[model samples]
Target: MRIDVHAHLWTDGYLDLLDSYGRTDTATQRGTGAGATAQELEARFELNDSAAITHQILSISPQVPHFEERAHAVHAAAYANDLYAGVVADHPDRFSAFAALPLPHVDAALTELARALDDLDMAGAAVTTDVLGASLADPAFTSLFEELDRRHAVLYVHPSGHDAGTPLIADHHMRWMVGAPMEDTIAVMHLILAGIPSRYPNVRIINSHLGGALPMLLRRADDQYQWESPQTPDKPSAAARRMWYDTVSHGHLPAIRAAAETYGPDRLLLGTDFPYQNGDLLRRAVTSIHDALPGQDATTVLDRNATALLNKA
Candidate 1:
């Protein structure tokens, strides 16, 4: 089956939930294109048929429910996860979801992870780059990672709207165009430097945006990691290959080809970043991959990789 590992579907209730949390941008964002209403889902299914996608794993990200207040975070996380659980139940064939965690609060997050997986039967968990300004590689998140390792679970890391704490980008209005990928690079590197993948080998970590400069940085790190971070357990390139990446480069064949070359074809999976790339653009996201690589390699990425990963998880 050709499954898209990176897509988002925000229900009106989910949007309303975020609004209650004081998320000011909900009005502009979260258009009907990303909603789960019958009409919107029909539009999404049409795009999927045109793109030849069999299934799409949905997630709530970039606008994740993690908050500063512990109680609020817990309520938000549970609300989002339960809502997505229902979303999956309602569309068993077309949709599955990654549960949202009340992160930066590891204990709460751990509890929610167990509930989401064991009770809600969520496919996995989704989180932003930084856990409300703390690095995921920070020792505080170690227990959560350990539990994920124990479960052999998947963890999808998307950019937090804050852009990984780079004020220059946030203040200068480079939020998505430049800041989003920068956040991806920073978050993944934090894990790489801390030996997250090497240590928690069972956890299948998926980085967004073709790993956000990882393909280009691996060689640089391989060359310098010995002196720069001798404590790192393995070569950055080697440790990086131990993880997975989604092909969501907005139909940019060169970027997709670069990521495939860096991570190998088997590690690449199809990801349309739905609603963001709807209509004709969504169709092109899949076709561009076939154009970027040889037929067999593209087929493996498009059809085989996601099924293998999800099946294992």
Candidate 2:
């Protein structure tokens, strides 16, 4: 299928829903060069065709509508899912999506997850690394994961833009530069240490940006996780292999190669953090994989892996 497992779209209606519901954080993305106009949309699609990216699995992250207000969170999530469902319906050949859930509000998230998956027929759910400040591994999120596990759904973990609650990264202006993947590293660490993968084996968890330095840190974690995180139910490496990662390290071949070496080739999927990685960078996201690995393995990563993963639904 040549599916790109990571792409993001922020429609005007989705942004308006967030703003009307009092979400001020999303305003900056309104016209950050990735416009909602038809011309820009066609340009994006044409670029996808150039890259041989037949399909794109879109998501909204770093600016998800996860306000603490129950009404606000639920409404925003429902609107986002409906909007995504419409796009997929209108362009099924080019788009599929992970549902944005109202997290830090599990029951509501559960409800919206049901609607998005069962009714809207979206691919699966996407959540930020943390809900407000709580970790995904926290027991508070277990029920949500339980339901996800039951359905054998895909859980896309994206950075929440808050920089993993770290003062150093949050205080500095490097939030998205390195902080984005830092959130990715810490969030996945929380899951590994808390046994998220082991506990909910069926939930196909996909981490962003090559699992946020995970290619480098997996062995270090495997070495020290025993005492550092004694309560972990399984080996860090074992749990990590159960999860998946996307090649979104700004098309860095070494990072991609390291990930392929650390985790098996099957664990990697093609991704371009679109708009953010648009134009030539988007094209490079695909071509770089072929450059970094053998022909057969690159083919599996670019095409076969995502087809197998998405079809698991």
Candidate 3:
């Protein structure tokens, strides 16, 4: 019943495609999103061992080349889909896949979504917190959301270093530690506040890195905007707390506890950030969190809830 909802794997063809796009920056080449082969990932996850994970959902790391030109972005997106498909095909038992897509281009993304799901048999698609210069709530993404809703597809969102050309995120250390979380928080805010959750309630969106410090900052965000009149008629409370998050907060116990406390165990999924991080570390972190919680609640967070999310329990 062990199902890790967040993990990444890439293929050589995919790396070649990303390299051809001519838009890779420091962020794409460094950090967690840096591309690695399936064999390397298997070794990292110790998949050859008897203690290897039972199931992993592979996703293309969001740090794929980001291009302002629509045509190049479309090509990169297709390449990503192909790479993810190949990875999952190679290890159908040990892995399942979520497709990568070009966002902010509804037509291209929707077209690829059909191919990825119908042709590749992928579970869903993975998107970044933001698409180029636009947020998740941008009008351009409405059709994309509607299409995913129709398919009842899962949308996995990972943080990216995008910030409207801001120079502050150029510092790699600063960007990943601070900028990435900020990007996640802002992107989730746009989706919730802009009414995407209510409009497309069936679409399941999973945010990585424990919603990127969202559980801790949500109260401040809620309190500050409680009095301000929303542009939309729907109250933000329901949509804000209703989203899902993964437990990949670098094994920080307090952060793990805070996320569970803020969002509750029902919406939390087990995530190891595998290949980039040690799964054993994640297990230890979850164990620590379980030690602090009352009764079987700890066991639920460690595995049961994730099982329910993936329907493998």
Error of 1 at 158 (Å): 0.6
TM-scores, all candidates, are: 0.97, 0.96, 0.86
For model 2, how does the per-residue alpha-carbon lDDT over 1-313 read when each residue is reduced to its tens digit? 8998888888777887888877767765777555446787799899999999999898977668788898888888887887788888878998899999987889989989998999999888999888888889889988999999999999999998886687898788878898889889999999999888988999999999999988899889989988988988888888889999999988788998999998888999999988888889999999999999999999989989999999932
Off by over 4 Å in 1: none
Candidates in descending lDDT order? 1, 2, 3
Worst 10 residues of 1 by lDDT: 23-32
Q: Give the candidates in order of TM-score, highest first.
A: 1, 2, 3
lDDT of 1 by residue, 209-245 (tens): 8988888889999999999899998889998999999
Clashing pairs in 2: none
Off by over 4 Å in 3: 26-42, 45-52, 163-165, 232-237, 279-295
Per-residue error for 304 in candidate 3, Å, reads 3.0
Better of 1 and 3 by lDDT: 1
Clashing residue pairs in candidate 1 (N, C-alpha, C atoms within 3 angstroms) = none
Q: Write down the lDDT that model 1 would get.
A: 0.88
> Which model scores highest in lDDT?
1
What would you estimate as the lDDT of candidate 3? 0.70
